[model samples]
Target: MVAGDRILMHLQGRSALVVGGTSGVGEATAERLVAEGCTVVITGRDVVKGRAAAQRIGAVFCRADVRDVDAMIAAVDTAADLGAMGVLVHCAGVGHAARTIGRDCAYSSAHSLDDFRETIDINLVGTFNAVRLAASAIARTDPDELGQRGAIVLTSSLAAMVGQTGQAAYAASKAGQLGLLLPLARDLSSKGIRVNAVVPGGMDTAIYGPEGPSEALRRAVSDAAIFPKRMGRPAEFASLVVELLRNDYINASAVELAAGTVQLPR
Candidate 1:
């Protein structure tokens, strides 16, 4: 490989599949990958959003929910068909606000067991489902000079480390991603695939959808930020992901993209 090609712009001629690519961080990452000359396939359950994002970023759209085993496998297949499945960025996740223990009321009551399980199922299990299926396909690819077959970027949240009042399920789910990283990386080492997780703090994303945070809650979250005094940008998250993919040395670690925010205890 040429000197420049070895270091910078390693994503050129690569192939990537981004789950949850219909919006937010996934969409931004897909766009960045496309700009880097990577063939990209994006998957999401929202067909309209997925197709729009795919068209916007010059990528193919596969409607797959991360929780669906067969559907996720198919999405991986769609990406692997492009080339070797060089990168799998899993940005699909869901979050809700419910305290584990609270006052006796419908909405204010303690977190339900069913809610916790659903969160775990969608966020943690869903992530692993995609990772396992994608890693299998990626493992089949011929390794590069460095014996690197591919890289996997899993999305975690800062709440995994320090959670807020109502973040029991979300934090547990995201923390599970971090927990899986080391073992998954070690297990896939023989296959020349690298696994890493990104822990992001508050970000300007539609993960909350229309019923997002109230003005008071938003201020509280933003005020906790240390430097720059604002929530993270999706592009910023994407840039870090691209960097991790280019640098083969970064593996099995959870990189925090929190901007030094020290969240106050609830």
Candidate 2:
């Protein structure tokens, strides 16, 4: 059976807000949430893709960048208005492809500070923005019989732990997610909120578009895996997110879904 078909109705009567749910893992997770009988809201900067994805999943589309505090609050409110807010999956982020130093003749072309800042703003800071606002709204609601009010799943990357060349900024931003997982879980535990992170390995997503990585690079990466010798499917990532939501005992953990692939110098 497909990933959507396998989802348990654990999310019935609850609501989920997927920040960056327009495509890839985010879109897959949104679809799974809907399959599990949750009212879902998805947010993204791309109106065309966001609306289309939401329509496909029968979810509400909120056009908001995760970096904007007011916009994130509004997105959270949209989900809460649907039902008791219980799930938040943050998947809005960008990839950094530029190297810390350019390979030009003079070697004067270094990665701009602005570029580094932008990566952190969108990936790290934006995630924190969504988490804080969403958790606040969730905390106001009463916990379930299991004493759990909400679950948050943040997307980290394998780069956070073992990044390849040209991934300094990307890896740092993802590592910042790891930094947030434990503390946020502890801080929100008193309110019956659970926070966790997923460090996904190379996945075949829009993040690496048709023009992104070469076929050889992709194959070599797949060959390095311990098993499941291929790029991960978005559904695989989504399945884990759903499991984390229903299993309350899985708080403050950073789960890796890379099939044991390791990073080598590019």
Candidate 3:
């Protein structure tokens, strides 16, 4: 909040819509956005968890599935009723585990075609749908006093650049997200919208399943040779997304948070 500090958001009384705001990095970013003075509308398919996060942050919960275009548009409609959606953050994505061959079968599993398609549909296409829907609404709004037209923050993964033994589906989807930044930024340029993606490393949050945080992922991570020797925190991811929310200087790019640990093809 200091003048010299890096946070650049002018979020007071503005509105932001965070997709997949029920948990993990999504929930963390929603909290940070709220704290930065943006009235937040958080969405997810899990009504219970979504409502909980919204209530906890003093925001509203909108039921939405990013993979469904209608639902994504509905989320924007809900934002319209609230206020100008000055920021849009898409954090809904699936982290998958699949291998093409059996080289790592002892520590891997093959994905069915259904699983592969679902991963692609939800992770890549879902992100694109959310951005299109939200950016359309944001483009209609007048610029802020700062002549800014809002930012779209997409979430990618380090796996997009360097996949491990069993991350074919996940890596492909995340890499697709990385690939969309340039085109999306160009397409939305005339509208004054900025598009960016965050390629965060593994973070410590409960985004795995209904089972809560995964000890198995933690074990695998420890067993593996990560440079930092530990998982990243959700707050760290949120911090970067918050910076992206108000930054006009950062556009058409993806930021990585891997701590130089993801060079190998593992």
Top-scoring candidate (lDDT):
2
lDDT tens per residue, model 1, 1-266: 65435743257888899999888999999999999889999999989988998999899999998888989988999988887678999999998778777776566576889999999999999999999999899888888876778899999999999988888899899989999999999999998888888899888877866665466666776788888777789999999999888887788989999878887776
Q: Residues 190-211, candidate 3, lDDT per residue (tens digit)?
A: 8778888888876777666667
Report how far residue 92 has shifted in candidate 1, in Å. 0.3
lDDT of each: 0.87, 0.89, 0.82
What's model 2's lDDT at 38? 90
TM-score of 2: 0.93
lDDT for model 3, please. Answer: 0.82
Q: In candidate 1, which residue pairs get closer than 3 Å at backbone N, Cα or C atoms, i.e. clash? A: none
Instruction: List the lowest-lDDT window of 10 residues for candidate 3.
Output: 1-10
Q: What TM-score goes with each of the models?
A: 0.93, 0.93, 0.88
Q: After superposition on all CA atoms, what RMSD does each candidate show versus the true structure?
A: 2.4, 4.3, 4.0
Candidate 2, residues 1-266, lDDT tens digits: the string is 55334432257989899999999999999999999989999999989988999989899999999888888888999999999998999999999877887778345688888999999999999999999999998898887665678899999999999988899999999999999999999999999898988899988887977475568867977987889888889999999999888875788999999999977776
